[model samples]
Target: MWPLRQMLQPRHVLPIHFDNIIRINILMMQVKYCAGKNIPFFAQNGGSGWAALNLTNGIIIDILPLNKVTFNTDKTQATIGGGVSVAEAMAAGAAAGAFILTGNCDCVGALGAYLGGGYGNLMGAYGFGVDNIISFNLVNAEGELKTVTEASDPDLFWAVRGAGPNFGIVTSAVIKSYPDSNLTAWSTALVFPGEQITDVVKAVEALRPNLKPSQNVFLYLTNNNGPVILVTGFLLHATVEEGKAAFAGLYALNPVFENSGVLPYAQWNAGAASFCLREQRKPGHSVGISQLHPEQWQEIWDRYVEFRNKPGAENSVVIIEIYNLAKGRSIPSSTASWPHRDVNAQAIVIPWYTDASLDNDAIAFAQKVRNIWKSTETKSTTYINFAQGDEGLEAIYGDSLPRLQTLKRKYDPENRFNQWFNIQ
Candidate 1:
């Protein structure tokens, strides 16, 4: 039986990590063995931990168990199995007195997220998740496993950083890690009543530069019975007092709620994860922008207010994240296929719909807002990680289209791994 045919039948299944290429081979052999007797089998890794999986037919190989972590004593590099979660990677890095740029959401897969240009709270300080990746152990289109690096396969390495899933399945990744220190981090939430959006915007803009490199600020617009302003920011410093002093200007805004303090790195990671916990069933879409001018903020605010007034809009959320980009853009654009290297802010408009019947209208509303933002004079770029499935490839790649396409054609002419945020 062919690989595809054996994979399609449902039979005894095994749950192993994607990094365990040997196990995958064993499972394949098992399937072949079963096929000899005309039996059917299938497997899957059903947790939300996977960043991306083969939604098409065939056996679903669970890569979560293949998690094995190792690190270099120099503190500049670490190796992680593809099945490792962002939280697991962080924990391992912390244990080694090192850290890697990762997403705030702990459940996201490390390899998949990093390869897909993952960004998170530390992005302002490091860069996209892909930037920290040094090399990868990948299973190519032909199932021949190989180690791809900047020197070994320059083009393939470049493509893998931003678009790896398109070329092949990565078994493990060797990534650059940062020194782990007891960095002081705090979260501040400011509240402004409905009519004070302009003031809030001005205050945020004013505090932008004052915010140290260790800080991340995000704006939340919601209509939970009434319009309110919530500015949540994280200040990373050597000490809690220092972080507080550095972000004093923001706290001076007299937020309705303040929860700023110091905690262990693990606790901080957990806190960050808590903020992203929302109902998964709610229809949602997100788009990131390079930057938004003050005038553009007004237009966005107006649409936000309009959406708030629409029926079934009570749970709508419009998040505007203004984080530092100096660290991320410091790397030359030519170094990787990932774009949005110079973006300073990311705007995500999420209009939630609880009723399934209202899905079409809710999606239309989200698209309309996205279109308005895309048509703006700001000329911002879209972040591939947050992009919705409906968006065209051109919209995501923008100026980087030619290079990405060239690399895509060269590495994945057949496009076997075209599952996530595909270029085509």
Candidate 2:
């Protein structure tokens, strides 16, 4: 047996040289070797995953070397490397006068989010990140590199889009892009008093049916120096008047603090920069809901206030992401493995602290907030990317769980890639 210290760290790491096809293929073969020896291996991306992962006595494949983003001549499609961040992709798209669907944070791994059914500001118009994937250059469990497209291999394609980490390592992917000569969005940040939680929730609910394809919004109960309820709204390709008209309900609330402006596509995720800080203990609990209940949201605000009062946990946050689902729902549900097409809102409670002693308290607080949201949900569902790992296969995979299990057996029978939300 390996020494405890050595076992705690990856056995090997080939960082800078692991970019090309030859190196990627060799890495896959090494993965197969690890599987044969009953040793574990993991692919490390932007290091944004908050799940508790066990990589002891395993190989950590640092995919950062594969960071490359290249767009086609017409700027309609771009190939994104596995290690690329959402910010990098957006920067590349902005440079090319195009837009690609990516998550809200600047530091999140592009492929990591895309594989788990990507959610972003552009999702209101373009659909989820998975919907834009043209093809994936994947190295499967058996050490074989193959190109996966809907037509090339239907089941594998479907399975990978939602549960890619469970099956293989995606070296790179070709994704659809939209060219916009004017790639700017009008965005606003609003702050409300804690007492206005019910009013804020009601405003969001009232605005839901009127949401446009170019609009999205996020509500938060968080600490900005101190506890405050915040709302961030985005409208793509819109002027100040157009944006204000679209989000009239929120404007009517008369927030205590407000900042509104137009931002380039590359700077769209700037507001989340503070939350993108790495190396802190941030265990997140999230759920999907069909409707926003004023009472439940008020309760959530109360719970957040209680938890945020904890000395070192002031940064903890409760957030609800609301998107226009018309464009995304227009696509058939069976088109991919993402199961929450019917969900109208996604909520997450992030309890952030560095003290190991606060683990139990934080977990309890997050779970309690999640329970409040779950009470309003008719079906238990969560976006895989937002899942907190203990939600079980059914919660993350939804109706796609059974079929995914079959594919897992056929492809990764020994469960080599079992780190993130493993398919059991």
Candidate 3:
């Protein structure tokens, strides 16, 4: 605490290790300084969809020292630092013979992803990442460091769980973990020719009703020379014997390339994260649907083909992540600002262009896909983290839009934390 007090300057410095509570207080003081003086700041981590927002003239704070994950003596729960990545958190939990909910991307910030209704392979079994969180210790707009939990401050806690960045600098959180230390899992990545894209989507949709809470599937469309091809990934938290029935329909598709095996849960969760696009800060847009009929899936495939055929769009890609919602569907919409719970899938468009003249075309292409789905969307919600551009309040927050705005007024009255998707 003494060292941090001496070092708490207004400028960003490389994070230095400090005791947990002391580090939280130091960050609270820094946030308070910024809030009190009306100086805006941005807390940067991964910045997965951060570039689309307006961050003009705000200071950036690096809070990496808070990236610690510790298990309780009895191992029912674990306290995680805000800066920890999925890879770090998963390994930490597995060390204690436990597991926690996290996204597929190993390098994505753990708390950041959880704060946005994190979707992952574990979601089918454990629900979204927010479902595992127990409490959060954050620096609010007032610069006061407060420990928030369902019992301590339900309203702020509800808002913080998924609608983060709208409130403050979350230093750490306590979350429920699963007892799957020895759980063996399976992952399958299958590639199909361009024409067979519909078969893959149909295969997934057909298996949706049979999918256990432990299974997850995602489809990817990208350029194969000139025509669009499909790549599919299937993950099951259970071993092959328990998961075989769930995968029977998928195997019938006869993919061009297939890989499936038994592996540690941690290894499957990590998946081919090396292939995740880390550096290209291109414009992207996303749309969510609970379930799409075969016709709708065909429409999405058709759109992907069109996007790939555009000039300088050779590197563009589309990823449709399927959320079986096995355990995730039972939650109340008010659980967090992320409104859609029954959504069976979400699709995102990443447009990379080499020609400056095609910038508008690229963004329009992404939005057109989103708009096409938006017209038929049963629920007016989009997953917060995967969303881009200026989607309306209803689309991002759903029925909880008004309540979140009110919470924004109560907590961040001046909206000091408005850089990243502003709640107001």
As a TM-score, model 2 comes out at 0.95
Top-TM-score candidate index: 2
lDDT string for model 2 (104-142, tens) is 898889999999999899988899888999999988888
Q: Write the per-residue lDDT of candidate 1 for residues 1-424, one digit (tens) a residue.
A: 0111112233334565344656656544544543455332222221332122334343444667757778887878889887787788878877877767777667667776787677776776787788888889876655556888899988888877776756766768888787856543566556666566776777777777555676778888875466677777776644667766666765666666666666555555664453344333233445665444555666666777776676666667777777777787788887888766666666766665445566566677667777665765366456666665566666566666787778777766665456556665
In the predicted model 3, the residue pairs found to clash are 124-213, 290-344
Q: Lowest-lDDT window of 10 residues in candidate 1? A: 1-10
* Candidate 1 ranges with C-alpha deviation above 4 Å: 1-14, 17-21, 24-60, 223-227, 272-279, 293-315, 378-380
TM-score of each: 0.82, 0.95, 0.89
The superposed Cα distance between candidate 3 and the true structure at residue 133, in angstroms, equals 1.3
Model 2 residue 222 CA deviation (Å) reads: 1.0
Better by lDDT, candidate 3 or 2: 2
Candidates 1 and 3: which is better by lDDT?
3
* Clash count list over all predictions: 8, 0, 2
